[model samples]
Target: MCTGKCSRFVGLALLPLAFIAIIVNLLLIFPNGETKWTNNITMQVWLMAGIGGAGLFMLCPSCNAIRAGGKGCCGEGCCGNRCRMLRSLISSIFGGLGSFYCVAVSGTALSNGPLCALTNQTGNAAQWGYHFKAMEDSYLFNKTSWDICVQPPNIVLWHIVLFSMLLGLGAIEFVLCAVQIINGLLGVMCGDCRKKENNNA
Candidate 1:
């Protein structure tokens, strides 16, 4: 059986790792310079979605333990309960903030969708117009024109839906983590009370 003290220490140790993961994800989503890939709205949307999904996954464990079992490893010692509470609280805060960042980025990227269509038109119009007539002069050059199109609305809609889902899950996990931290604190106090009673007996 795991003691509360041991659980708290482990939880505390894991907090830094989780925080670092969040930082790395943010960097990957918002890279350094202008490049061909970075210019695409669809690519940015996917990147944000990926980062958000990862953050949510990282924060999920603390949430799951709290819901599945009332007391997470941290039992009733000075190191256990207090450390567990601190770790949980910090994780909850980060999770909520990360979710907000992801959703905001995703929304901003999607809003730029029209620019893609405009760029395609401006870049291709002149060349296509000339090619169309010339093609007719050749052997059956039907010169069908293709318009610059955004990825279908349905595909973008799915990315939006996924972003929203990840945000909601992060929120839920934060709340549950907070509740577990509070429960751990109370458990610590109760354990002290029982110890005093035993001493009196």
Candidate 2:
């Protein structure tokens, strides 16, 4: 016996869950400052989150209006047919853009494969890129992907990790879009159901 309001609220609740994931993903490994590390997959994640967030914001209002039968609760034409159309347009445009970015990043990451690592001239374990290591001692002490290691056959592990996360986030964006599509479809029929319920009452 879920009312339109309840359904609308449920849809609204999912919006925040995606936002939380975006924030956490950004904070997990992305660092600040204009460095090579910062420029890695961080930029892609930011764009995806921004586009997805804006689309979700627009979609939520449209869903609420549809749940209430093509009209907004404000009674001032806030959720009219035009509003729903415009919201759909905005959601589709931005969601598609966001999905494109997510997919591109994920696809690139997948092509790179897993098990990235850096090795020494003798095939010994070391940070990726010997260029990052200013000296032999530096390589021994600061053995991390964040450095300027330019070692031969450098397979930076940190970048791989971030790329994997980017791919995961992209998958999440697609899932969110799917949910929106299902909700929108169900919303169309829900309006008719509401009318029937009112007539029966």
Candidate 3:
């Protein structure tokens, strides 16, 4: 359990971390921005973009409240910053959902197989294993694993590491977002904070 001051510090630290997440998410969505045939959009891309957008949106009030020295309370000793509180709730609900989707996608990716599939089609190993998972008529997932015929070595044990990373990130993001929402809600609870504060006083 973090104190108000401690929460401020953590929130401030998360600002940069959230920014990094945004950048990584954008990169994931647009792996080849310059390519003419780069419109290979996917559900994962949309989820990543939403997560990035939510993180970026959460930063504004977090930064403001932190910079304000935590004086943005709706009530005395109740909430810290009103905007931040709202951001936290939004982050918890929306950001948490986004993280869930990301994790779900990564799960889909690993479960279907061929996360890092490659093949020399014209060369010796032409019969690359095709992996497909039909979620629906509109959402068809596909990938390739490897060419067993041409592979003397090239193992993909590291796919485990990648899957773990995705799960870890999603879990962390959901936790942080929940924290923000709860902290914010606990801190504020009125239309007119000043009026409520004065009335309470």
lDDT of each: 0.40, 0.43, 0.47
Off by over 4 Å in 1: 1-43, 46-57, 60-80, 110-154, 170-201
Write candidate 1's Cα lDDT for 128-173 as tens digits: 1112122324212212221223322222333334444444443443
- C-alpha TM-score for every candidate: 0.41, 0.47, 0.54
Candidate 2 per-residue lDDT over residues 95-124, each given as its tens digit: 545655656754543343322235567766
Q: Cα lDDT for residue 79, model 1?
A: 38
User: Candidate 3 residues 1-201, lDDT tens each?
Assistant: 333453476467556656655655554444333232124333444555334543564465456435433545554444445555565455456656666665676565455433222356565433333222322321122223233322212222222334445655666666666666665565545322443555679
Clashing pairs in 3: 79-187, 85-184, 88-180, 88-181, 89-181
RMSD of each: 12.1, 8.9, 7.8
Candidate numbers sorted by TM-score from highest down: 3, 2, 1
Candidate with best TM-score? 3
Which residue pairs clash in candidate 1?
A: 4-74, 4-75, 5-75
lDDT of 2: 0.43
Give me candidate 3's TM-score against the actual structure: 0.54
Candidate order (lDDT) = 3, 2, 1
Please name the candidate that would achieve the greatest lDDT relative to the true structure. 3
